[model samples]
Target: MIGARLDAVSEIAESMQTHRTSHASVLEMEGADVTSSQTEIHHIIVSVLSTIGRSPDIQRGLTRIFHRKATAAEFIAVIQAILIAAKQLQQLCIIEDKSTNQQRETLHSVLLRKLISIASSSTVINGAAKLLSALNKEAADRQDLHNLFIISDGKFPEVAEGTRRVELANEKLDSLIVVHRKQLRIHKLEYTSVAGITHLIELPLNTKVPPDWVKVNSTKKAIRYHSPEVLVALDELALANEQLTVVCQATWNSFLTGFGGYFAEFQAVVQALASLDCLNSLAILSRNKNYVRPLFVEDDEAVQIHICSGRHPVLEAVLQDNFVPNDTDLHAEREYCQIVTGPNMGGKSCYIRQVALIALMAQVGSFVPAISAKLHVLDGIYTRMGASDSIQQGRSTFLEELSEASDILKKCSANSLVILDELGRGTSTHDGVAIAYATLQYLLEHKKCMVLFVSHYPEIVSIKNKFPGSVGPYHVSYLTSQRDVNGDFKSNEKMDHISSEDITYLYKLAPGVSGRSFGFKVAQLAQLPVACIQRAIEIAAKLEAAVCNYTEQQIRRSCSLSHRQDGCKNEPTEDVLESDSLSSGRVEGLDDISELYRELFLNLNFGFLEEHGDDRRLQFLMQARNLAAQLIKLWSSGKSTTRDLWVGHTSWFEL
Candidate 1:
């Protein structure tokens, strides 16, 4: 297989050769003629092939042709024929070495490389392409089966000369029969089932028969007979014709097999043609996709990848013009690790995959789908991208994820390209965040390779401050706007309510942290139940409020732990409550109300901030605030004061 892009090989040769070598100089060889025109030489070859009578003739004709000037077309033609034969014989050669079980170079591979090298030369490119086209046309037409060097235009000289003698004898016998016509009667000529046996079916009535005549078949009215001398002549004719036919067949088979001796030449030609074909295919792809030949720096230590306006090759092929292109810059100095956070439908996976593909394509010596690309040589590309479980192997999604990640860390080097998406997503939130952080840290501090880490965990992005320049924080841009909003509503109700078209994904990668993944929006996109979407929206709002309040410390409360007798330790002392109650004239205002119920709040888990009642409830609503506000309203009904409420709730701590 001419697997390497032949254009790259051509370029390499061009760089080394500097000035182009002329076609005449390249075609003119040590043992070949330097004077004859290619057309004349081709005619000479066709003549030699036509005259081939036996294996010896095939050998001599081919040797003579080889001594003549070898044009690129003629050379490629013979090589093409050899390739056709090699395909049948390829099974005879081992594809790989058994001892090492690795790809072992064989004589087959060597000859193939030589052929490709020859075909890629400036002298042969045009001539060989045209020659190959003609040869293929011949194959399609089934007209060019001249590989055996057998001359097919006319009968062989040996067959013709021998058959001529037999025909001449038969003609003389017929003449004798005509001469003897005055004396002998006419007869019907016929043949028997026996080989070369002829007979006279009958003679004319009352005809005079020769004295040496012998009757073979007798009819009722006439006798069938031949002269003894004529029979002898007929026998000789049969022998002569039989010998001639036998010789012709043997010579024909031998002539065709004669080319088998020149397998080496045929193999070289086939290899060259295959390489040229591979180059043509890659050229077409490059042209159609607007691909650019990536630039490579000579410095091996300067490992990096810089792409301008790079598009996903497969996506561009499919979506064409509509696939958005993006830019990437990953270097050894900084931006070594990119933590890409975005909404579900954003192009994070696409972006990372494009970079890796471009790297692979560069290594394969093909142009990449980018306006400009400067890349370092990568040893290999490692990816843990999607959620693929190994059911047959008994590996769950998380287990598969861990296994792939482990292997990447185990084998990847500084020159490798690593793309990881949503690492550790199959575990608990805290554990997943921790594992993701650890994985990124391992790559950054140890591997230091070009990495694209995609994650949804906002807690994971905290590492940006830890690695600063080495780790980048980026997300796909999106828009968040209020739908059908009235400014007159209070802060609480507006904050809790979510409306349609509340989130619009931009799909553009922007620097800094993304606020959220918009899970509810993605759920809606997935066509999840409407009730499910509404519930998710409500929980998300509550969680957001809880997180905001936690960050601002706006609502602090006391806890009345009902689990134990000493649970109310977090509550304010009796003396302090009494002092505040006396300092404030009416009832104590609800400031620092969180401290009043500190024990109860302390028992609440972060998960409780989600959906408080049912259905994996995740809400940002402050339940503690509502309870406090209700309690204050109840007491201010002129029935009880703040101090009296706390005293009365003393029994609530009795677990």
Candidate 2:
């Protein structure tokens, strides 16, 4: 029996390996667009069954299951029962895509039901249930029961159930009777008369079912009700010194049909699994690295890459009601760093983390939840953006931040992306600012790493001013004032309000810095005292004043320097020049006016007109008259018309 089991094991292994090899070939060609892993596993099971012969029992069961004769729930129960038997036989059962609704009837469910039903009925062989019932009891004085039928999947049912079944059996004759699968020892108890006992069933397979067979001695007495031919066959087989008996063609056929049905199911599953692009490829080259640079090619240089508006897949699934999608833009000019500032509950952390996770997912060969993207390739991503402590490692939250930040700074290169949120917040304000300042300078001067840093400190905004065009500052905007006619501010005070329900975030990214932290407001909303809010405001005011003073001093110094280098001048001066008469002749009314002016000047010279004043005065009067003539001419031909190019009219202003 052990040798037979070994042979079966070898056969199963070889079969699995062959199926796996073929699956690998298919997967290598499928690439990233493959179906999921569960689908692939289902495919493999179907394929394997196709290679093997289908059993008739399995066919019958499948026919019953598929035609809706059996409900899916009942079918699952039946399949579980067969698995229970096979377990007693030391067989393996792997069901993939079991819980899916797509396929109404699975092969394993169909096959197992048939086997269990057949094994329970009698052509000549005793039913496994009936046999176990008889064997579990003992005949105290008589030696009557002799025959045994053991059917098992090789696992044992729980002891409590088995004990109950044992107590239920009526056959008597034992100091010892049942052989427990777990203990591998026979149970010895008081014996009852075994004069009428003839059949035994042992179900040592699954933890649910009873033993399928019982040991029968040749010296035991036989009853007249036993079949003569079965007794003769057993005697002959027993004479041959064989520990295990062979099943006849009829029984073997039944098993093949039943088991083959399950095999077909297993094959279907395997084939389905193999059809998935990822799993198939994995089957072929299981050693390959898990890195995939997505096909997000940037079409236009000017288009800002929006990792569109997307939710983190894992986070979204977990936070079904509370999940809010965030957007990211990677513009070429704002390449390296993006400093994001926002009030509390504005989703700054979620935005940064979602972007990092999306990038990671893209590289890991999964579809990203984005409307569209033109992503640049990133080799690695480092994040020091969240707070967590490792007390076991004797590390505090600040220590963890320092460790993560140091690692990020040391390892990040031009292609790596880094995200740090409130980097120095766990420490003193001055120390945090100093560390953040030094970190920014190091990233700017030493490495061209892409960074998205979220912070409340206004000092990071100075990076945008000092390193012009290197950093882009984005502040999440909020409506400043909200009030009703009663002069009370509207607050999101309801504690029962979930993150998703009635939550409104402006979500727009604006330029410049946010003015205040609403920490005290949030505390008040959480039922804190008004004095606490006042104290918070006072502290905030002092900080704001200090920052304003520094900025003012810096502004004054720069303005004074600019003022020295002819920098007080605001507008350009233009020089006056005499007009060219020939150039001016093209004017419509001015042409006639110029001719009239010349005539007047000549008439004055020839004494055809009376001079109203001295010669110099006459010349000045003529010039004034010429100007008036020009003005009158201009008035006469005022507002020259304009025609479109389609009308084919050329104008003085035509290009």
Candidate 3:
């Protein structure tokens, strides 16, 4: 129902005359015309059509009327609401023509005709006429009539009799008061009313009163009494007032009951107004943001999403001009899956989210934040992003991740738009890679949906090789400086060695895989301790070297076994021969080099190195170079594994 309403509204917005009017100009005109009543009326029409689209009274009244429990005031409110909408529609037709161009006059005429048709709806007209006829003209003219109940009583004789009785009782009470005053012979003697007491006679303390008069109260200067006749008249007055209230309520209920037959018609008017409100809101959004209407292809067409220079709708508003736009192109017949890779905070998630949001906005019949967008309507949009776990549900983060992935695999179809960000990140590296790889393979080969897959694992990009043109590898582009702000040269030995200080995020997408996520740079940006960051970098480098060494050792062991199995008749492969020579040249003393290095530097005071004078730093560096020279010389001459040589040379250096 909402989608259908939005579709109708979007169609109206696309064909509206206000599309050509600049929102800025409209704002300026609105500001300049603040004092003009006509302009104020125009603003009212716009507000009614846009912001105040829904009428709660009309909806609730319809329900109450259907249940035979509506009140006269509720019926009055619903009728007045519909009548006001018709008034606003007429105002809109006039207001719209003032800004419409000559070339669009015919279109404007057609639009006005439609508005006129709604305003001239027989139900609205007859309902309003009936309401006006039923209400007193003077009461109807008041701005607030919620409490006004001055309806004609000719049809309700009970109310008429109640009113007449109350009037006669009041006259009889007044006549008795006059008679008491004359008999007391004191023109000033009058009723002394107290809380819940009325028509009590007051006289001087020394004066005498009738024996039938009941003494109500006494003060130092006066005595008060209630006359028997006055008490009887008061009872009559209370009864008349109570009876009048009951009959008036019944009369009002009867009045409201007359409008029940037109309940459907009133509801239709309110719905039309609500829809017009939505259409006006969409028109305003499109004009203000300079958003273009998206073109949707037929359902039978090949599934495709091709957006040019699309911006994240919400981020663009917050960032204003600083927001960067990126293009998206996915075709089921070609590359339907994109493997997105980039450093943290490089806009990978933002890019994929933008595409999904644009697709959703387009399908909802709203203009998209893009240069242009054209796509086949998607069946569904499935997203698996962020990390969370439910403790009460007995699910860990990894379990939750896999559960959503499993659901997506089960439910998503070829026409679905799937966005999976950093899938399998909660598990071990090898397991994460395997899971992410298998998931992408399934999505590509089985579902074949349009997928935007984001991951920190570079190995995931290798899936493109298997799928060929079906998979595309892309990354958020960035720039890196060679030196830090302090003129310290950045390390070049590692591809991912760049620090946060040396990196500049372009926030734009580009083709090719990013070898590193540069998470340490993100750590630096987050202001982690310098010592902690340095230690992490060192540990990462060590792990990389250890993995490489392990691979080399495995290859050498396999080659040696193959050679032995073949009886050493055939020459070994080039890689095996190189490994053999390198292994043969390994100095046995180097076996303890790792332990010696750990003892020397594991607890080194990095803070001391940073804060100490250059003289002391240079001396410490010289000792390090001396130790390196001794190790190189020892490695040059093959010696059996021993700790004596390394210990003897490093004995003079303090740990």
| Best model number under TM-score | 3
Worst 10 residues of 3 by lDDT: 602-611
Overall lDDT per candidate, in order of appearance = 0.59, 0.47, 0.69
- Top lDDT model: 3
Candidate 2 has a TM-score of 0.42
- TM-score order, best first, reads 3, 1, 2
What candidate 1 gets wrong by more than 4 Å, as runs, is 1-117, 120-261, 485-499, 538-655
Give the alpha carbon lDDT tens digit for every residue of 338-445 in model 1. 889887878889889998998888777778899999888788899998888989989899999999999999999998899999999999976787788889888988
Superpose all Cα atoms of candidate 3 onto the true structure and report the RMSD in Å to 1 decimal: 12.8
Q: How many backbone clashes does candidate 3 have?
A: 0
Model 3 vs. true fold: TM: 0.71
Please, what are the lDDT tens digits per residue for candidate 2 over residues 259-301?
4434444334323222332322322222222122234544443
Rate residue 432 of model 1 by lDDT.
Answer: 85
lDDT of 2: 0.47
